[model samples]
Target: MVENMHERPGAPSAGDGLVRLYGPRFQSDPAAIYREIRREHGPVAPVLLEGDVPAWLVLGYREVHHVTSNPQIFGRDSRRWNAWKDIPADWALRPYAEYQPCSVFTEGEEHRRRGGALSDALAAVDQFELRNQVERIADQLIDTFAESGRADLMAQYALRLPVLAIARLFGLSEADAPSLAADIAASADEGEEAVRAHQRVVARMRRLVEEKQARPGADYPSRLLAHPAGLPPEEIPSDLFLTMGAAQLTTADWMGNTLRLMLTDDRFALNLSGGRRSVGQALNEVLWEETPTQNFVGRWVIQDTRLGGRHIRKGEVVVLGLAAANADSQVRPASYAHASGNQAYMSFSHGLHGCPQPAREIAEAIVQTAIEVLVDRLPDIVLAVPAHELEWRPSVWMRGLIALPAEFSPMYADRPAG
Candidate 1:
């Protein structure tokens, strides 16, 4: 057993025992539980997941580094993770095996190949096209809410913006994009049915590519249809796989977190609307402060390996503590060393398979673009509801409010400032 993680009352018990962090209270407010364990338990501690599978939740930054860096020892295959397996086959997860994209879950070169194609597309995303489309969507959303003077930002802007951006980028028709986004997100939560819905979307994208064999258009799908390397027709299916994956929840969560932070944290509001440098720092702080992913980074142990004093058996499943580890004292201070503030957050995982995008940099650009529009266009903005009352979606892997309301003067263009 590790030392007591926290000494105070209501703090969780110490050590790597089978205590449930997802237990009811922990679900309601996880921040407090994390602090309790950090104060008492060491960074890496054994956790009995679902009260059965022997697992380790690496809490401290150093331990998280250790877990993520050793992919060979810790597995990336989610199927091997027993947490999903414990669900009955008849339950939504029975077909869960087929639902996930091979890009992030698999290791080494293959993962690189799948990601490479998408990055090529990401690179190809026209700055002018993206700016033009994204701004229009922003305006569309603002227009919808302008009359009421109040609107749910999550339902209205955060969710819609990324879905629209990704839809256009992937070459999916505007008519087809919404269902695909909802289906994929559902698959993340409800399992196979949701997975099937998402799979159908992928299949549809593949069909679109095939029909365009001779008359490929100027869109993204059509470009991939005409890539110089000559992707195998079979490989085209992977494009949908990659696109479905390339820009889904990650962007949506960022939108939610950015807006939430903007509305709730006043310091963030001032700096977030500032030019690129200040905006970049603020985004980094949010990633450091509140990592949205609840799913720990997964890896399958290959050979026998002992980590953090625990022996990880061959073929055993291990997941790195993205949340716990980011909050760990060491990761923070070390990251803080270079920067002036506590901005060491890890939502995209690290080592061989972290997010390839320049997150801190691009995040500033994307949200800053949105903020500039908001500030110049609708200055006296305020949240529709009290900050504490926002609703958070459950199932530990994601941390975003389901809905956020905003209120602003509708006729800002017409009225003169006081």
Candidate 2:
């Protein structure tokens, strides 16, 4: 466990009242914590990252929208962050907070050019073909555990399906998909393993780019290389790495969280056994209630500004409270039922830096299909353990289950091939 901030010498004084964004309380039930923070500190509250680094957490819906919309004042460049000097070389969040040459950190026309190339590449993907690919992957995954009567869905299904589809989209072979998926999961974690895992992902992407350049195909990497943006060869790997990491983890959590909601919530219990009527509703509700991405290490202030009744200094970091924003009373409907069909939540952020339309479509297709296929294959599936007994991954950045143990009637009968 990380030592309490109060016990560390020279830490922000107790009177400062800056909340640590990590630790047990935040991981266990972040929604409750967000409400408490908003009650005491208003919308924009002072907070500490790992090592007690200072930053602001934007809790109000309007404040989050404003910050994401006004890119000129709040930039994407992490190099400008005032807290970089205080960050350790081996910071667990370095992969997200550090400046890299990818499209994620670029600004102005440069960003438009690189982002346009990405949008175009993703746009070229045939949605019909992608959906078919996801369905086939989903069926094959179910075949492995369909007869076991018990399985960990997180490791066995939700975690593996999206990466396999993404790897295929990138033109990687069947043998490489498993290792790539493992590396992506490890890279999202803390400590030395994450760092090394991230390096491996990048190296693999670099090799993929080289191979595509020599022998072009209908894959994402090939489309990127052939795009008219004239992106440099060296930079394509970083962009591909970012795309894979973002899609794999976020989509996996979307599936895992949706399954948890369906199995555990009384609202969706009627549809748990091969009912598709509530699948769309459950998927949308998860985005508003239990989004895969809880918080983001976000925009750096370009200059001093006043937001959400708080004074933010230039170069200070402002974490986007995406989950908090969705729960903001000002915009959130009084009841979950009322919030249906209202897709304005900040799960995907907003404006230039938000998830692109094509990427969102691909993710929705993969997640929706994965869930539908699972329910269809194992109509009698039920949670092996009580919902409350299930543990969440202990990370501030991502919200997902550590495991989703489930049980169903064993089936030894032969199944039709997809």
Candidate 3:
């Protein structure tokens, strides 16, 4: 049996093998756990995921870059992976790592083709109009909870605004967007629910795509349909499925984490209230400290390679240690130094497979606008419980609060102009 690192001395470590990435232990204080793992195992730590899935988690600043930047050596296609041959097809990790027709799992000419279609679709978004949409969505969402005197920001505000914004961008009717957004959130989880969620999202996106193809509009789906990439019928929905799901989830989490930090920490609260810092600064700070997706998976080994001085066999999977890399001593001499600059952070996952939507400015606008609206509407907002008592989702990948219960003086909703 593998010895457990977290076990108290003299206690049995039997049956406890590689470090489990799931559970309350990792969820409660992942930063502390990440530091311990990096210290003992250096940059490349062998970790066991939920289903006893063994994979190397790359923790160093330079090491993560090395693996992510070299697509020739470490391919994105999980179908090439040989490690899962013996593992059950229904293993928890399969849904995330399984082959998909989208850019996340593709490489070479195929990736460029699909990725370009997505890039063009995103580039078409008018920055000015997008920011306005974000502000509008924020106001609409805030109207729902302003008079309640108390709210779970995670559910009522942080979550709703992004989906509404995405729906507007995709040209989806208000009625269809919320259900699609729910599917996106569910897709981020593990187990049978995630599988079902994936299916539902695909079906929903396919219907949207077919409708768009019949009567093309100036929105994202129509743009993708018109792109010279000439995406196949089967692949069209996959593209929408990947892009919409990614945009809604990441943007929501980014907003949620930033708001949580602002509400819980005096440093953030005082700065914002006193005008010492901008919402953009708060965003940069959160990206460095508590990036929405702490770990990115599915970079398969194309050949035997040395990553961070450790030998990795072919077909082995390497997960990007984004949150760890941002906090790595080598990247920043001191942890707190990350808050000083708005420079690039690994929160976007670098290299050819990096995220393209919600460009920096768009993300900044969405999050900044959302927070500003909340503060404007409820200036006295404060956490209903101790910051430490807030619960985090138990998933190994997602980094977000389950709910952010806050209290403030009741105010009537500001009715929108007809």
Candidate 4:
């Protein structure tokens, strides 16, 4: 219904366009930049990534739905991208732009085939059992730092719990969790390093797939192996590879961001103090505000088309501004109540390409469980460093804390290990 179809009158030049994703300015405060972009270029704005690779960054709420839902026109399968045809083999984004055998990189019936496997695999998980496992991990994590009185929650808790849980779900041994976690974390980094890390992760997953094939176990990976999707032997590990990377990063970042909000924002504390809000409500707020994945990868243009009033040519890349779209004032409620009952945010995206693991639900469960366990055990927990001084990692597609240092009353962690 909102109809200002063409690019806004004062759109910036391509050379001096929106904020660069890999720069410090974006790392500092991207919301302010997103606002400036919306004012000048409407919902879809011209932006540059690490290599000055031009793309349209979609920032409007309705606009996001328009592109994501219409995968036929806005294809996610990068193998079809026309622009990459000319780029050198060593292009910085090649690692991502290149074709992978994962469902995330496919389109149409192929996507359905692969995604169905992923969805079925995820659906088979027992939510109650998953929560129980998460809680056990949370308790074990707290036990490590409970007596110290001070801990970096980012490292000691937020980042590790989800990874550990996911590793277990994949039926990996306790010893493999740390190494797999490291590979997953590194794969999310920028530049050639990310490419190298991705290769390492793929190799590790291939080994895992072979292991599961020879001696299957009662885990998600094994489920994928037995599924009716009839996924090729080569595709199985690639699917698992993508699933592991996506789950670990998003869940970890979500937990970290939510914990950061509770520790840094006095309003959240006051809400808890007055019992006006629950930790779950705080999570919805974070999803709407500081989205876990700040931005995401390319949705290649299949043909020239008009979107959000801009002229998008075939083969050009379009990135979804998940956090920015969530902040779109025209679509988002003016107050918290309007957003409360209807948990509609671009955090999980909307259509076929949306996250299949129920990341939002899993994150909420993990974060709420972790916070409740921490607060119940250490009622006096407080921030070790001032909130304003905290640092965020610079990422092309993610926004996360480097560390979340907190101080709490020391106590013995006598909880039995699972």
Q: Write the per-residue lDDT of candidate 4 for residues 1-418, one digit (tens) a residue.
A: 2245444433323577456766788788888888988897787888877777667799999988899889988998886666665566655566666778788888899899889888888877777988898889888889888888999988888888888888888998778877777767766766667777788888888998999999998888899889898888788878888788878888888878877887777666623343234567667788887877878876988987777877777877888899898898876768765466656789888799898755545656666777777666676677899888998877767778889999977997458999
Candidate 3 residue 68 Cα shift, in angstroms, is 1.2
Candidate 1, residues 1-418, lDDT tens digits: the string is 2223342222112353544545456656766667776665456555544334455566666666666776666666665544454545544322233235545666677666755655565566566656667778777767777766677877777767676766676556777767767775665444346547656766776787786685666566666656654556666765565455435665667667766776777665533244323454555655776666655535666666655545555655555667766666555655432463554466677777776664333334456566556555566677878888887764345666778878877653356768
Best by the lDDT measure: 2
By TM-score: ranked, best first:
2, 4, 3, 1
lDDT scores in order? 0.60, 0.86, 0.77, 0.78
| lDDT digits (tens) for residues 1-418 of candidate 2 | 1112232222222347678877878888999999999998777888877657777888889889999989999999999887677778777778888888988999989999999999999998899999999999998888898888988999999999999999889999989988988888777765667778888999999999999999999999999999899989898998998899999989999999999998898777624453577788888899999999889989999997777766677888889999999999877767776566889899999999999999999999999988888888787788999888988876677888889999988867666999
User: What would the TM-scores of all predictions be?
Assistant: 0.79, 0.93, 0.91, 0.92
Better of 1 and 3 by lDDT: 3
Candidate achieving higher TM-score, 1 or 4: 4
Q: What is the C-alpha local distance difference test score of candidate 3?
A: 0.77
Q: Ten consecutive residues with minimal summed lDDT in candidate 1?
A: 5-14
